[model samples]
Target: MTIKFRFHPEKAVEAAAILLKLHGKPMKYIGLLKMLYIADRLALKTMDQPITGDRYVSMDYGPVLRGVYDLIKGQPVDSALPLWSKYISPRDSNYVDLLQYPGNEELCEEEEMILKQVYETFGHLDPFLVEELCEEEEMILKQVYETFGHLDPFLVAEWTHDLPEWKDPHGSAIPILVEDVLRSMGKTEEEIEDISQEAQREAYLDGALPKIFG
Candidate 1:
């Protein structure tokens, strides 16, 4: 059986914003992507639902939220691209910068905590002397690359590659179904069945809402 969840773009952007804010500067887009994927995985394991509700795919870097990845690449995934772009800049030199604060209204307290914890584990930037860095203008980009290594994007990718749910796509993208993740998390057949049914119901409601209220 196929399982799908309606992607919530606001939550996705807010999650990214939260991470970028924690980093306090432009971050390697890859690092942001990895942290978002890890947060979703953790949420799935503990909360029984992914925080972003995004479609997942195993890519060369690791598992990624397909819609968010498209947004990062400046593809219009949906109306949410404007929302994402408003708070986050397009990819620049392999990095993305936060343009402004995007409030986490769609995220709950637990979700915020999870994102923060994920940042601490994988992307928290240490306090650095801005004035000292300003003096070394020529090394700014070099510093970013060096700092990013310490921020753990590559490390996170390697760790995620070790997950049972992650498959090496061999340079091609492979869909990572929610059922696949559930199974990897040791969810029972009955539980997966129930979750799939619930997802179907949610999708139906998502479709009917606009028609019903419009």
Candidate 2:
């Protein structure tokens, strides 16, 4: 009498097949991973996060571990978890180094000029980011404290939500994630694609021909 939120075995196999197709020539392990990561990120965007003792785990992990507990008998999962997991955890540097900022002290004019120059040069963005500052510079700066824990209050109103991001599960993260995988698979090197070029352009190109043919 054990129930689990696990994928159906046949379904899992088929899903793995689909992932293989999606991953193209990637190694089996890498392809499997991309499938899982993409699925988890998507699930996070659409579901309530699960409660797990001290910290809330992603809703994706919830299904990945449903049988462990009926747990307080069906209370709704908390919404705070997503904000914490997505915005706060990495900021604290307690977990995986997703996207991290040194700190958001107002960049000196020289620093600002440097960032503007570098960001403009390759059109790249903050490190450890899953998405882009796609919002207004004001909005992005406002969140900088939350993101980097030290943005100057004076600069809070600067970022607009218009920069850009990769699409779908990727949003701002698509380009980096794909490229990291590619690099790991020996497809490309860090020096090849200029970091100034936004990951969005690369991901868009990745999908174009397939979408066009489809």
Instruction: Indicate which candidate wins on lDDT.
Output: 1
Q: Indicate which candidate wins on TM-score.
A: 1
Query: Per-residue lDDT of 1-214 in model 1, one digit per residue for the tens?
Result: 6988878877777777767776878888888887777767766666677767899999987898899999999999879888888988999878898998755556665556666666666674431111111122212212222333245577877777888878899999999989989999899999888888888899999899999999
| Model 2 alpha-carbon drift over 4 Å, by segment | 1-4, 47-214
**What lDDT tens digits, residue by residue, belong to model 2 across residues 1-214?**
1111222222222222222222222222221222223332222122211011111112311112221111112222343233223322222221122222222222222222222222222111121121211122212222222222222211211221111212332222222232332233343343324321433354456569788997
Cα RMSD to the true fold for all candidates: 9.2, 20.6
Q: What stretches of model 1 exceed 4 Å from their correct place?
A: 125-150
Where does candidate 1 have its weakest 10-residue lDDT segment?
127-136
Error of 1 at 21 (Å): 0.8
TM-score of 2: 0.20
